[model samples]
Structure formats: C-alpha cells, structure tokens
Target: MAHTTDETLTVLVYSDDRNTREQVRTALGRRPAADLPELDYLECATTPAVLRALEKGGVDLCVLDGEAVPVGGLGLGRQLKDEIYGCPPVLVLIGRPQDSWLAAWSRADAAISRPVDPVALAEAAATLLRSRTAGRAPATR
Candidate 1:
C-alpha cells in the first residue's frame, strides 16, 4: 500500500550495536520527504528480534547493519528476502563501497556505507519507501 500523507511508516532497523541503530534513525529522521508519511522506527538488536518484527508485518522498510556480529545484516537480509513473503525493501549499511556486491547478494534493494551520510541514507531510504508504497497507502503502524 502507498503511504498516505498522514500514515506513519514503520521502519525496522536491525543492528547488534545500539549506536549504529541510532545513527540510522538520526539519518532517516521522522520524514524523509515532504510527500511521505512520518517514519516510526523499530530497533532490533538481534536476529530473532528482527524476525519477530518482520513476521508481525507492517514494516515499510528495513535498514540493516552489515557489520553486526554473529550474524551480519547481509546474511539476515538474504534470509528475510527468501523467507518472508512480501518482504519489505531492505537498505543495507556496509563498511565499504566494495561491499556493495555483498548487499546485492543479500538481495537488498539499496546499499550505503558506514560513517553514514545523512543525505545518502535519507535518499536511499526514501527511494525504497516510495518503491514499497508505490500503489497503495501504507497500513498504519
């Protein structure tokens, strides 16, 4: 569903590190675009938490940290893409531009590097959000 002007989009951000999650949240802000709905974030610090959130649905976009431990976001993104029907568009944060291939392998819709640039992250996130909400207003969170 395409997000309406007032509906808040549910964004799932996954990372073992809290700071990384915070960075992502900060970069994306409450509304990436004047045309889009406000963003509401769900932070996940572990794999199971991520899955649990996804299973419940309503996630418009996912920002995954590629450097997470035990299980990196790249692998997790791939798993979610395969396991979750209608999986939300994924925007992965990698350590380097060279890792873009990994993000592609993970089936992420977009990829950006660490030391997150707010402009880039916001742009990428907005693009994915738009793609997901292309034809219907997003379901309320």
Candidate 2:
C-alpha cells in the first residue's frame, strides 16, 4: 500500500508465535515516542510474508523475533540487508545478550532481549525510527 503523509510510520513486525507478536505490539503501543510518528504495524508470520511486506515498500522500521521458526529473524535480517535497497533499520528480539554478536552479524540496527521490557523496546525502537526518519530522502514523506 502506498503510504500517505499522515504522520504514521509503517512498522513491519515478524514472528511465528501470535503471543510474541502481541507482546511486541503491546510494548510499542501506538507510537514509540511522541517525537516519532505514530506506528502502524504490519504483522508477518513467515519468512515469505516478511519479504513480501518489505517489498511493498514504505516500511520505516522492522522488529523481528529472533526465535521465529524456520528462517529466524537474525537470518532474515541478514538477507534483508543483503538484498533490499536502502533497507529500513531493523530491531531484533534476541534470546540472549550473548547473541548480540549474532545480531551484529545479521546487520541489525539494534536489538533487545526476549521477555521484552516495554521501556527498553520502546526506547530502542524509537531510536531506530528517529534515525531512519532523519536519514530518509526528501520524497520519503
């Protein structure tokens, strides 16, 4: 769908589990911050769905559940970075702090651990959204 200048940023969230996706949506609420655009989530349950969402364009940022089945978020994030031109900043949900290296390897822009803390998730997502918004080309709006 074409994004209009309605002050809402598109956030693509991928997770194999419904509960995991719900937690992410709840934590993010309507917007990560007042300074950032209000979020409109595009939920994806599979790797193919994620790819399709990204392909549709106007994705301001992505939140990926690293524990997702089959193709995990980290692996998908890497693929996205490799293949998508001007990919949006990605925030990965990790299983462990030690997996930070893996997140980096995936070329994720930011990460937070599971049992997600609402504050931390919101803050991290907001940071990425702000950064991506700032870096956007003039016609992005």
Candidate 3:
C-alpha cells in the first residue's frame, strides 16, 4: 500500500554524507504509503543546515543518520529534543543493528537500520506521524 498524507508532511533528513541523504530522499520519494500523501523531504547534510531549516519552521518529522561521522544523528536528535521547543518526533538510522539500544538511549521516537529499506522507512515514518497527530491536544497544558 502506498503512503499518502492528509496534509503535506515535511520531513527533515539529517546526514553528513551526501549519498546517505540522497538515499533517504529516494526511499521516501519512491513509494509513499496509503497513510501519508507523497512525503516532502527537506534534506540536510550538516548540523547547522538542519538547525537552520528547523528555524525556518516547516518540519513535521525528522529522520537522522546515527552513523554519520563526526557528529552523529543520535547526538543531533538529542540536541534537537533538548533545544528545540516542541521538537518533532525523530527517527534515527543506525548503521549497526547493535546500536539500536543507543537509539533508545538517545530517545528517538523510532529507528531504521542502514542499507535502508524504503518500505520499512516509509511505514515507520507514517506510523510515527500518525501517532503524533493523534496525540495532539487543545494547547491548554
């Protein structure tokens, strides 16, 4: 089943490697599930680029690359959770399956392993977005 969003869901993918970022974009673009309309990916290859994009204010979810050299996605995810107000749910891609625990430690909403699976990634993204959308409240604290 193809994924389709009710409204456009802006996804931010953070990876230092150009190929990894492109791979993610390709995965998302290929087959949007029935749930989410075609995904709109905002790709970022640097920490500052991710932050800068967020500041402009259109991201609905975040997919981060945990294996990125230097500053990894786990660290980036944690930083966004801490610094960004109402930080969006984060999905981290761990190159090592063993590091799934680390993804939990980073408090990521969900994760996908590297050598990515387009279907799984799309499903996970859709699930997380649906859960988040369903959890919204009236802003009364």
Candidate 3 displacement at residue 94 in angstroms:
0.2
Candidate 1 lDDT tens digits, 1-141: 344556788999999999999999999898887678899999999999999998888899999999999899999999999999999999999999999999999999999998899999999898998889888878554
State the TM-score for model 1.
0.94
lDDT of 3 by residue, 14-124 (tens): 888889988888887833566554567788888899899888776778999998878899989988988999788899999878989999888899989988999888788
lDDT for position 110 in model 2: 96
- Model 2 alpha-carbon miss at residue 52, Å: 0.9
Structural RMSD, model 3: 4.3
The lDDT per prediction is 0.91, 0.88, 0.80
Off by over 4 Å in 3: 1-6, 135-141
Q: Give candidate 2 misplaced runs (Cα > 4 Å).
A: 1-5, 135-141
Candidate 2: tens digits of C-alpha lDDT, residues 46-98: 99998888887888889999999988999999999999998999999999999
Best-performing candidate as measured by TM-score: 1
Q: How well does each candidate superpose onto the true structure, as a TM-score?
A: 0.94, 0.91, 0.84
| Least well predicted 10-residue stretch by lDDT in candidate 1 | 1-10
Number of residue pairs clashing in candidate 3, backbone atoms closer than 3 angstroms, sequence gap of 3 or more or interchain: 11
